[model samples]
Target: MEVDTLRLGFIGFGEAASRFAQDLSQAGLRHIVAYSPSAAKAVLDDAIRKKADDAGVELLKTPKAVCERAQLIVALPPGSKALAVLRRVRPHLRPHHVYIDASTSSVKDMEQAAHMLDGVAPFVDAAVMDPVPINGIKVLTVASGSHAEQFRAALEPYGMNIQVVGEKPGAASAMKLLRSVCMKGLAALLFESLEAAQRYGIADVLAADMARFINGRPFEQIMKRFVCGTAIHSERRIHEVSESLALLKSLGASTRMTRAIRETLQQITDMGLREHFGAREPETIAPVLDAIIDAKRAQRT
Candidate 1:
């Protein structure tokens, strides 16, 4: 079948799904259908409804409508909801169809999801490797499955950078998680290290010290600037991180590292260094940190 003729459908019409639909549209795939489990959101949220309409995405109400309209269905629900999303679409799946899971699933979890689809339809595990907003649909992705090549063939024509890692079901997911560990660990370390430098009133020296380390990470450019600027807006960062912790708590998701970093930022904020640079960012980290020291000494007196 021609790529142009294929009907692209998304199971979750959230941010990722909308971006992919628009990207595919740009690549000459004119027909796109999307459905959300919260289909009622269209009535409640004008922005969401308008987004679907703007992307040329035909928003349907049921998984059955989504499954029936398109031969390929991309499941973009949250990792935790992957099984439920699949179950909802399961009754409508045919052997001729393909279900590509591009959710945040663990290796074992992805394997279970694939096993759950046994004999129903071909299931491909897709590991999203970069932020979709910045990279667009060309965002690097690793896909693994019995139908890996088939998945690549259909999508690569549409600006997707899909490579087959292995056919072992969860191989792509493993690689993605390994990459996440390194990148997120660097973010965590960057924040903590800067907080240490701030404490000693030597943050400027540490910025130069960290230049050597930042050049080696995956997202070095972005991470370096973020590391250097986090303290200038420490109060905002603390509040944002706190809200993130609250969000994860509400979701019943694991927040061990999130809580750790949140508390770390909280310490800096409470130390009176928050927005210490005022409306402008200082060239050296020492200016703001010196303010922190002055404030702390004043408190002691």
Candidate 2:
């Protein structure tokens, strides 16, 4: 399939959605439309109008309207809100249309979504493997589903590092979920350990040691991979961590670390770091960690 002619619709015109649409537009694939529930009609309409005027694309009014205009729909809404959006647009889905979920949702949610859209439209679980802000055109995508092959063919023209994981509806999301177990868990561990060091009045020394411990393979590097890697690509890292916890439980392994990681991510989310750090590189988190250490030290003093 020629990407140049493919009509793409995006639900959730936040940073990731906008970035994807902008990237595609720059690539000369102009048949794109986007809708954002957060953007007021006047605001969204104006932004869409500017994009349309600048790039020659349409900005539709509703999610269903966008669905109606494109053969491929990329759902990039928040993890918690993804299912509701899916339910809303499910009825408008057509047999020829391919729905790609780029959100961070549970394996169960992905499976349910697949079941709901079964026989109506092909559903693909596509996890964004990197942050679109950092990776830009080189974004890596892990996709799985019965229709993954078709979806890959359609997305090729946009120039992506897309990998097809399997023919299962939730395989891609599972892969991402498992990875979050290690990645996000490490971030939380780093935060806790560093804070403890500050409590001991050895923060500087520990930070230096941490630099060496992670040296060529530092925490920042790994985090960069996760933040710039998965966060921007998929909106579902939190739910993915939950799925990883389930995997650990099935294996009869303790979920202490997973649970701690989930809590820390929740902290980050609650602090609104998701918006600030979602598309930032790993290095961007260093200051946040430093501030955390400082606050802990002040409390101790």
Candidate 3:
């Protein structure tokens, strides 16, 4: 598809859509239209309208109008509103239209959104993999569903970084959630520790020490060592976390994450991890994870 000739439509013109439309327009795709219900007042101070104007995107009154005008439509509403927006435009969607649902929605929601367009249009479940504020339209994104490649090919010409992960509707969303589990957990852990350390006026020093420890080796190697080491030394770690949690409470800092950590360490200790290892540390993380899984399965049974 020629960049200049493609008519792009956005169902919501929020920050992500505005940044994307602006960059796409700059990249030579001139015909961009959008419809945001909240911005329908058409007042000069309307934020979405201002964004659309800055991006050279024509603002339509309804999503149906956007569907009628463009062959490639992007659904950029909030995750909760994504399906509602899609439901409204679904009836207007045509066989030639390519619908991209680029929202941070649940896997089930993505699947439902794709199903809504089953015979009407090609559906692309695209997960924005990076901060759009920093990367703009070229933000890293992973796309899935049967029509993912088509969406990627159509927009790659406009500097959009889209990787097609699989042919399943929720594959990209699953990847996003998997990543979030680690990223969000690590962030919460850091926040808990830092807040406690700040009370002792050692937050900066602790952060520096943590940086050195984390950067000393390849993360994969460190990850294996930590997981395997935790299994073998679960009892000692439980004691250490107990002391830390008490200190955090004294400092008036939040103890939620630390308390959870202590409970998890106690669970591992109670699972006979030390006895399973028999004073020997596991060489890999798999054995420790498998033991935990087995324990959980046994409890369920």
Model 3's TM-score against the true structure: 0.84
Give the runs in model 2 whose Cα sits over 4 Å from its true position: 38-40, 43-48, 51-56, 216-301
Best by lDDT: 3
Better TM-score candidate (2, 3): 3
Clashing pairs in 3: none
Each prediction's TM-score versus the true structure: 0.69, 0.67, 0.84
The C-alpha lDDT values of all candidates are 0.80, 0.75, 0.89
Q: In model 3, what is the error at residue 25, expressed in angstroms?
A: 1.7
lDDT score of residue 285 within candidate 3: 84
Per-residue lDDT of model 3, residues 24-100, tens digit only: 98887877999887766678787777778888999998988898899999999998988998889998999989999
Error of 3 at 268 (Å): 3.1
Alpha carbon lDDT at 160, candidate 2: 62
Worst window of 10 by summed lDDT in candidate 1: 219-228
